[model samples]
Target: MAGPNSDPIVSATTAAQLPPGAVVLHVEAGDRQSAEAAFAAGHVEGAVLLVRDEVVTRPMRPGDGRHPLPSAEDLADALGRLGVGWDAPVVAYDRQHGDNAAHVVHLLRLLGQDARLLDGGLAAFTDPVATGPGTTPTAVAREPRPWPADMLPDIDAVAAHAAAGGVLIDARAAERFRGETEPLDPIAGHIPGAVNAFYGDNLTPDGTFRDPEELRARFAALGAGPDAVVYCGSGVTACHDLLAIERAGLGRARLYVGSWSQWCRDASRPRATGPA
Candidate 1:
């Protein structure tokens, strides 16, 4: 999965202090009322609540999985509407254990934008919370480029990786990875030769990401390196693991964007049950 070497993207370790002029993006996939209720209770100062329907995903198709990515143009439009400039340093947060926020951070990074998930999410906020609606920035119309080609691996690439004995990680729950329980997708197993590294393991009990050295040790157990490929049920939660990998300084890993949902759709693709 290792490709071109690029400059590092700076991140904020805490919610209280961010890169200057950083925009706080609060992404929650729950119902609007509850999300707004949570936002009113206290969101980072000057943070905006990005509506779930508006930016979370696009219409689902048979092979696109439950949470298909929106078009780059549509995403650019949404961000522009929210006043997120192409160069703006963004700190995204969500109450759902950083899954939603990680998704946004992943996409923004894919688009070559400076974005990072607030470590520990909203709970990590040590500053005063602001109530009511979010502040709108002076709209900036910037034409966004297409999604980076190297950001993800397609189905064929994933199969090749597995066949080549490349490191492939399943970020689903251990039970789900073992085919013991699958409450979402129809499939109950993981890709052949894929190791299970439950994304939640990257976080501490309080929900903040574990220390980088600890994370490095955990991924090292799975043989994670620059060539690793990570996936989850439908590719949303997988970003959390990818972010963890980056935070651990483990190098860039490719994402199987369609993930298990897309893989299982084609019965010809090999699927393995139980522990790898």
Candidate 2:
């Protein structure tokens, strides 16, 4: 399912057209048990599995936000167990318009591995489904590579980026960005000088990403480019926007992993209200 130059997205129809031996991954956001239950019912044939917590993240720590990323060593182990060879063509899919899938795809790409998201997610696929326990290949003993330093930005880096006129795109909903309502982090509003580009705007009514040209225009309006950085409530959904940016051919943007949760923890970082 790798697109031209390993494009970051693939239609489910296009995914079905992939040659044999391409590794499929079912990415779902849920607790461990719920994910297992869903997988037991059925999944894409030969798809590797990644549940929200087990494969996508680590235990939350004080000031670490709701979805702290797993250590690179841990992630490498998980990848090995999934049989993701050094050059394997991997595809990640989720029902939520690639919200969860984008997270995994972004991580893989960050690690210099080739991967793509299933555009429109699982609903768009018409292939036969396999049921019951899925197989996980024996863990490969490849050297664990540390997550690229520049791919993720800490709170300090985010502040500096904004101060230096770098783009800091908040992927939260407009209301949340405006401090009008916040059901998650205690603090309302967003980082000062940060612009809101609600992640949902990247998709169409059918849940597939908007056309590349349209996406380019949308992000171009937001000053998106190599210097732009993206953040969401906890960092998971921000990957969705990053993926969209890449699909728009904007190149890889930095991610503020600690995001709002980390920014709000200090109570000293400035927050803005009522949009940019």
Candidate 3:
């Protein structure tokens, strides 16, 4: 069910839904301690743990923001150490629906690999559970490749897109987008001309993604078409909206990797508060 052009999301009520020999990754936010604890309790057979902060992002700095993208060579090497080769079909999932997994899958896709998010995440996986730091396959060799130009846009591109009347989506909580509160970053408010489309809204009450037609209608109402540019506070959760857009049949949307973290740090950039 997975190939070069398959859907970016998949559901596995049973393990059969996953492509044969697909490399399953259990993604965790921040650190590996909690992930390791969870995995020790129970996890799908052969699924390896990947801490988001450690594997996909670099240390926070003034220009790069809280979670900057890792170098292409570093990412390839990390995946190769996890036994993921160039052509492996990767299925990434996390405990928090699919937000974390979506980020990993998004990066993998940018590197020209076939990657997908496991819809419904660990809660919906019906496969047999394995405990005690499940055995990982032998490490494979992966050649490093640059991220595609069109998929990863810098702050300048996002600004130009907004000025051109393109759909610029802010995938953060409404409160954060409205400048009512600032928990993580130094700034409070979203980029001017960007519409709020919180990533969590993409999931159903059961934590699975909504139907494709439903998602299509939801995003269409927000003025997001195939050319939408999506971002979040730190450029992590925005992938949830991106995957939803692709699941909605709107094609892949570009990611603003630096996102609001980069945009808000500059005193020159204008910030807008309240609803769009």
Clash numbers, per candidate: 0, 0, 0
Candidate 2 global TM-score: 0.93
Which digits, one per residue and each the tens of the lDDT, describe model 2 over residues 1-276? 233234688775644575456678888777868887887776777776788678768888886877888887787777778777667778888767887888888888887777888888777777767788798665566557787678787788889999998999999999999999989988898998999999999999988899889988999889987689999898988989988888888888888888887787777788888968
Ranking by TM-score: 3, 2, 1
Per-residue CA lDDT of model 3 for 73-124, tens digit only, reads: 9988888888889778899988889878899998887676788998898889
TM-score of each: 0.90, 0.93, 0.95
lDDT of 3 at 131: 81
| Collision pairs in model 3 | none
lDDT of each: 0.79, 0.81, 0.85
Candidate 2: deviation at residue 133, Å? 2.6
Considering every candidate listed, which one attains the maximal TM-score? 3
Total backbone collisions, model 1: 0
Better of 2 and 3 by TM-score: 3
On a 0 to 100 scale, what is the lDDT of residue 237 in model 2?
85
lDDT (Cα, 0-100) at 63 in candidate 3: 81
Q: How does candidate 3 fare on TM-score?
A: 0.95
